[model samples]
Target: MRCSCCQKELINSLTLQELFFSSSQRCYHCEQLFSKIDQAQVCPGCGRPNSTELCQDCCLWQQELGFVMRNFSLFSYNEGFRQWIETYKFMGDYRTRGAFVLELTEALQKYQEYLICPLPLSKERFEQRGFNQVRGCLDLTKRSYELLLKRSELAPQSEKSREERLQMKQPFELNVPIEKIRNQKVLLVDDVYTTGRTLFHGAELLYKSGAETVKSLTFAR
Candidate 1:
């Protein structure tokens, strides 16, 4: 397979071990540039790499919201990872989805009891993009649903600064019945978790709808 980032032919073809243990979507060079969060040195709240304590943002979340969100992030948002997102999400390179499917599939298996929900894009954005970037990356064998809906149009979160993003009002609504998700653990899936504002908003709604717990899983943070 070709490298997802550079589009170069992979020098080492996928091995049985690689197919089983690692995501061989990108070549060695590209793969090395994208670092996974070290399980040991991560923030308990956000899962950011190399943090021994709850990051300041999450501490604030606990203070203001009275609870800390438990989030799992798969990768650090490094330069190479940014390029991967640009290609897959902005440029709409569908093939890039294959690179992370194995990884996501493996991660999601642990949350089998939770209802999986992808963060919804605004109607205009969905029409323009043709697919949800978060959903595109998932290769789930079990059932899932597009349960969240955008409450209204808004500027893309990526376009906003940290402060601006935090100030943005609630942007999502539940399309599914409250009864369906009531008392269920809900997993909010997104392509990236920047400031945690978006996911927190999602979690708040889920909680109000009677969810037992709300957590997020992002491809990157």
Candidate 2:
């Protein structure tokens, strides 16, 4: 076996249970490059690490927008994660999508009853990138997801400053019929949670469209 990120031979021995029922695409060395957030020690609101209470961004969401969203994330957006994103997303290495499948699948088990919805890339961005990074990961899980929202082309979030991101107008519109969202519990999936602006924008739309509830999950925060 080999590590997906480093492409080095994986030397760890697997237990009988692991060999029979578990799969690991990333070796311990590569895995150690990124920090996994301990769910119990994270912020109740945005899942930011080391926070016993809601983080500042979450508090702002509640006070200013009158919106509260529970976002669960698996990893921190550390240097290693940034490099992975650069290769997989920006450099168009589609195979790297499988690296986090096991972790993502485990994290997603509790949201089985909710409709999985990957946040969209604009048509222009999709053409340029060749795939939606979020959808790429979800596809490997063989999890059914709805393309419920469509995004209009704007500057990429990576190019925007935090202030610009917060001030941006809504970029998403419903892609599916209102009946699909009406009264459904939605789990918005994304690659990362930056300032929570993008997720909140999508959640606001879901609420206006009559979704029973809207929460989010991301690979990183």
Query: Which residue runs of candidate 1 sit more than 4 Å off their true CA positions?
Result: 1-25, 140-143, 153-168
Q: The CA-based lDDT of model 1 is what? A: 0.80
Q: What's the distance in Å from true for residue 133, model 1?
A: 0.4
lDDT of each: 0.80, 0.87
lDDT per residue for candidate 2 within 191-216, as digits (tens), equals 99998888999999999999998999
Distance from true location, Cα of 14 in model 1, Å: 5.6
Candidate 1, residue 88: lDDT: 77
lDDT of 1 by residue, 125-165 (tens): 88888888887766433446556545555688999999978
Which stretches of model 2 miss by more than 4 angstroms?
6-9, 12-23, 153-168
Clashes of each: 0, 0
Q: Clashing pairs in model 1?
A: none
Cα lDDT, model 1, residue 84: 83
